[model samples]
Target: MGYLYIFGTILFTVYGQLILKWRIEKYGSLPPLVKDKILFLLQLLVDPLILSGFLSAFVASIFWMGAMTKFDISYAYPFMSLSFVLVFILSVFLFQEPVTLYKVIGLSFIVVGIMITSQSV
Candidate 1:
């Protein structure tokens, strides 16, 4: 059940990130002027998809709080790094983002770190 809470946090985190990126891409880049940029962001704020993204973040935080009660921070925080690995792979496929060797190496390290830390549990 504790692991489930952590998993929920990871899923919500990933969903929030991906949804925001997808929606923002559709909205295009920020405007050049400061006022225009403010207006542009305000436009996104009302978007249902963007709102959902924000909600997902809130949900993720709740899940993280639950996780906090279930395990030591040292034992659980490493799992959060999995979000980075997931987002990296996901962005490559969903956004056609490039996968550099350095990124692959970094992700490998994250996975290894998680594996090592999970042993403490």
Candidate 2:
């Protein structure tokens, strides 16, 4: 059940990251002018998808809180790295982002680290 909380955290974290990227891509590049930049960000803030992304962050935090109750932070925090591994894989496919060999290796290390740390508890 505690692992479920950690899973929930990973899923929500991935959703927030992907959603924000998708919505921002729709808006195109940031404006050069300072005033326009502020307005551009304000517009994104009001966007429903963007709002949901932000909300997902809040939800992830709640899940983290739940996870903390069930295990030592050292035992559980490593699981959060799954979010990065997932988001990295997901973005490459979902967003048509490039995948490099170095990135794959780096993420592989993170997964290995999680496996090692998961055994420490």
Candidate 1 — which residues are off by over 4 angstroms? none
Count of residue pairs whose backbone atoms collide, per candidate: 0, 0
Please write out the lDDT profile of model 1 over residues 1-121, one tens digit for every residue: 9999999999999999999999999989999999999999999999999999999999999999999999999999999999999999999999999999999998999999899989944
Evaluated against the true structure, the overall lDDT of model 2 is 0.94
Alpha-carbon shift of residue 104 in model 1 (angstroms): 0.2
Question: Per-residue CA lDDT of candidate 2, range 34-87, in tens?
Answer: 999999999999999999999999999999999999999999999899989888
The residue pairs found clashing in candidate 1 are none
Candidate 1 global CA lDDT score = 0.96
